[model samples]
Target chain A: MQWWTLFQKELIENVRNVKWVWVPLVMILLAVMDPLTNYYLPQIIDAAGGMPDDTEIQLPEYQPADVVMMSLGQFSSMGVLVIALMSMGVISGERKSGVSELILVKPVSYLNYITAKWASLALLTLVAFSLGMLASWYYINLLFGALSFGALLQVLLFYGLWLLLIVSISIFYNTLVKTPGLVAFLTIATVMLMGLVTTIFSHILEWSPNRISTYIQQMLTTGSVPSDLTGAAIVTLMMIVFLIFGSVYTFRKKELAS
Target chain B: MALVTVEKLSKKYDSSPAVSQTSFQLTSGKCVALIGPNGAGKTTTLRMLSGLLKPTSGTIAFAGMSQNSDIRNSIGYLPQHPVFFKWMTGKEFLVYVSRLAYLSKPEALRRAKNLLERVGLAESANRRISKYSGGMKQRLGIAQAMIHQPMLLMLDEPVSSLDPIGRRDVLTLMEELKEDMTILFSTHILGDADEVSDEVLLMHEGKIIESGSMGELRQKYQTAKIKLGFDGDLRDYQEKVTALPTVIECYIQRDVLHVTVQNMTAARHDILTAASSEEWPLTSFAVNRASLEDMFMKAVNS
Candidate 1:
């Protein structure tokens, strides 16, 4: 019951701040922009008018699945950053402003507090990502061709987990830091470092959460599940659980010192 | 009856202690003031009691509660500088807090409305908290703290940041509140403590120096002195006042003659008789009772 109240407060704060509106708007724009730009690439070049008049530019016919993957590519970079920045202040800002001090004084448990935050942000991210992906899928069918609905659901499931990993990482860092900017910096840095390591050591780090994006792309295009897909998904789920527990532990120890 | 008993409650930061071996009790229906200077650990003590900070080594046991049970259910705390959800309206904020205390939605709304009216914020209940002035915010803070109707309401410097009008508003509200539940509030201003508190805990340098009822503290530190002021000069009347049989010591400080007396009643009669007979130009005469400031200074110094 206490967790429900805290979650409602978090949701209301996001709604009041219009985070619900802008985050999904940005996601939709990123998603739709991919298909629209890909479909109009030749005309865009013609409109640019910078190419030689006699030169002919040949472009490949993009597949709907490829366009969806392209949108996911945009999401993994810009969309992940957006989600990270949105959740950067979840815990740190309340501690700095002294609101946490007042709230924690009640009969609320530390686990409830941390879990409420994680659940609220997770719901927002999943909802926004789902809306963005569904919109992109619709556009992909209309512009290029029809992709299997099963593929879209699979992409949403795996890709949403990766995005949630960003939210979880952001929340964990928020509990560990007192400054929102520092939290944002640390969260983004962690994600980028993981991506770098996963790229350089793909074979050894096959179970890495960062590889979920690659497995997702493969799943969408070839309709073949990677052998390490289950491993990556399991590791990602374990990391999310560990982060939520770690956040609760850190928050209990810190106790809103400011 | 004692409602809360805290024993050896100490909080240490890294190497330095913010509160050390402090034990105190809150009597039911009494407003207790935790009085101390800045950096005296009053805030730390209140935070521990509210369960916002863990004590370094101590046990806080409330009446009728089990050893390991959560004491926060009976406590409502307002931090020294309370920051609320500025985007929330006053009524919405109170309702939110009430629900956190586990009140049902309709019950929370009813309590929120009643508290807003009680705190005199009913007219502005729908306004966003960002639009509230400092005093309005303080009142709203008090209202939220009381929404759950906890057994004890703890406020850390509830009025320290308010202007005069705001201070009076909070003080008056506290005075009314102490008639029911126990209230333990901290303040550096001795005057505010003197005005509203029934008992006082004087703290200094991370330790409680004195704790007692307000009257008990005043009597413990009482100097039994009489202050005399004159129109022209104190030198003329100082010698005469000192020669009185009941006067023990007489000294001039800041244009007033401070006369410590053996007996207050006899001293008053003797000094007034001399002033009337000698026709000395008397400006003011006051029988000095020990103020909270005097008790605080004596306790801290001792």
Candidate 2:
């Protein structure tokens, strides 16, 4: 019961701060720019370039699925950055300002606090990513060709799980870091570093959470899901669960000095 | 029966101790003051009792609870400087806190409104906490603490940061609150402890130096002393007064002569005779009563 109440508080905080509205708009903007840019690149280049008149540049024929993949890639980079910025202060700011001392002294459980934070961030991720993807899908279909909505939804779900992993890690870091800015830096650094490492060893680390990004792209471009989809997803979900529980455990023993 | 019994409670940050092995108990329906100077561990002790910070080694047994049981539901705590979500209105924050204490939504709303009225914040209930004055925010902090109607209320330096009016407002609120609930508040000001507390606990250097009712503390530390003031420097008379047989020692404290003596009756006679005979320009003279400052100093030195 208290969990539900605290979750509501989290949602209210997000809405009052306008993150619920602005974050999705940012995501939609990033997603929309992908297909629009790819569709008009050659023409835009010809207009902007002070190049010699007779030079003919060859460009590959673009596909709707490729446009979808480009937008997912945009979501992976800029989209995750936005998620990190939005949720970084969820716990650390309260601790620094002494508000956590006021709330934690009540009969509320630390698990409820962490769970509330994770649920709110997850909700934000779902709403923002869903809106952004739907817009991207519409643009890709118009600019390139008709693509399977079913496959688009599948890839979005897979990539959404990956975003869930990032949000969980961010929340876990929020408890450990002392400042919001540092939490943002650390979370983004960890995500980018993990993405680099896993991509470099893509075959050997088949079950790494970062593979979801590649798997989403592969599923869209080839019209077939990755063979390691289920295994990598199970690993990612397990990691998210572990991070949430770990955050709860750490917050329970945390000494709130402020 | 005692409402709370704490034994050998100690907390160490890194290796250095902030609160040492301190033990005390509180009976039901009593207002106790934890008194000390800066860096005296008053805040640390209160934090431990409120369960906001874990002790390195100790046992705290609240009434009807086991030694290690969670007693947070029965305790309300306000830190030295209470912080709130600036984005929340005073009423909304109170309601949210009440809900966290397990009140249903309607009940939470009812209690939040009631507490706002009780704290004299009803007029500004809808005002954002960011715009609240220091005193209003403090009153709201207390309202949130009392939202659950806990058995015990713990406040750390409730009025230390307020203006005179703000301090008076919080102190008056505390006076009214102690009538219904047991309260243990910490303060560095001895007068604040003397103002409303039924019992006073003096702490220094991370240890409890003395604990008693205000009357008992005064009686225990009472002495036969005389105070004298003159138009001239009082230090000139310190030597003359010390030479008298009944006078044990003499010192000057802010233009007043404090003469500690063996016997009040005899010392008064000898001092008065010398003042008249020597034609000293005396301004005021009287036998002195024990002050909380004097007692606190003695306790700290001892």
Candidate 3:
């Protein structure tokens, strides 16, 4: 009940917080605007060059499944931006304002405070991703033909994992840096670093035929999606653990009298 | 009955001690003033006592030990400069903190609103804290500090930024609550200290310089003070009075020659005799009592 009270406060204040709206607006623009541009790009290209003589322009086949996949994938990355933007001051802003002292002084432990923040953000992302996915599921069918719900579910799960990954990164950044500005900038920096490292390692590992990517490509190309739940379950569990435990661990050392 | 105790408390940022080996006791219903210049560990000590900063080494015990579960509900703190969520109204912020402090919803609202009224901020309580002036924000800070009605209230320079009116408003509220709560407040404003505290704990260079009631310290530290005022050419008369036996400190200010004599009864007689003999311009010669500020400066400087 007490955690709920704290969560409610964060929810109210965070939703009212200007950054929350700004970050989502930016994401919404990316979600809808990019697809619209891609849909109209061929026509724009042909009009710009005035069309070659006696040439027939072949339009790429449209699939509502494709739209959903493209939109979810791009918006999934945007999810990281939203979460990072909203959570930049998870630790440091309170420290700056000297509220850490007042808050920690209360009966509430640093654990509860950090957990409440993570839970609030998680709840927010769950709802946002759910709504965005459910909406795009229709918009994709409007532009293309019928898509499989199973495919939609897979894409949604992928988007969900991406959000979880982002939250983990945010919580980690929020934990490591106790200053808001540094936390925000460092979070973005860490994401870039992670991408760079992953890209370099992916290239290096591809030389010997990477196992993880090979399995994923096999699942995609050969329609051999793994029936076993082990990898997905483990990743989901780790994401949950990282969010709750990582936040509490980092928050413990933070002085409430910040 | 030490309501709060700090033993062997120390904090170092990298290497230098912010608060070094500091220890003190706060009894129930006793107002202890933690006085010092900036960086004198006043804030650090306050933070440690209020459980804001973890001491690099040492322990903080409330009513005996550092178990927060038992004591967390009964400690109220107003930081040196508390930062509030600007979007939250003062009342909302206070209620939120009160809820975090474990008050029930209705009780939380009641206590928060009552505190706002106590601090003379009831009308503006609905306004966002971001829109508040420095003084109003300070007042709001105090109101929230006491929302829990904690057994011990630690205020860090609570009224340092207030204008005269705001200072009086807060100091008056503090005076009223002093008998009801243990106040561990910090400030360099001797006037506020003299007005509100039962005992003063003066700090300098990370250690307490003195601790006592004003009269008690005066009785122990130095000779008595006597005010001797005489009409006409007080500077010349002050010179004569300093020359008198038993008189220690004599300074003339605008025809009032204030004299601090070692023995008041003996000095009175000598002054009367000299006035009659030398025909000095003397309308009156009386002893002026010392204020706590004088005694405080003596202890700190000593």
- What tens-digit string does per-residue lDDT give for candidate 2 at A211-244? 7776777777777877888788999999999999
Ten residues in sequence with the least summed lDDT for candidate 3 chain B: B63-72
Could you tell me the fnat of model 1?
A: 0.83
Cα lDDT computed for each candidate against the true fold: 0.88, 0.88, 0.72
Error of 1 at B61 (Å): 1.4
Residue A100 alpha-carbon offset, candidate 2, angstroms:
0.4
The C-alpha stretches of model 2 lying farther than 4 A from their native spots are: A46-51, A222-224, B233-236, B273-280
Model 1: per-residue lDDT, tens digit, A1-258? Answer: 888899989999999999999999998888888789889888898798758878877778998878987898899889988988899888899988888777777778889888899999999999988899899989888889998888888888988888888899999999999899999999989999998999899879999999887787777677877877778998999999999999988877886654
Tell me the tens digit of each residue's lDDT in model 3 across B155-262: 999999888988988898889889889998999888788788887788877777777765576676655666666665667676777888788878866667777777
User: Could you tell me which residue pairs clash in candidate 1?
Assistant: none
Candidate numbers, best TM-score first, in rank order: 2, 1, 3
Each candidate's number of clashing pairs is 0, 0, 11
Q: Candidate 2 at residue A103, lDDT? A: 93
Top-DockQ candidate index: 2
What TM-score, over all chains together, does every model reach? 0.95, 0.96, 0.88
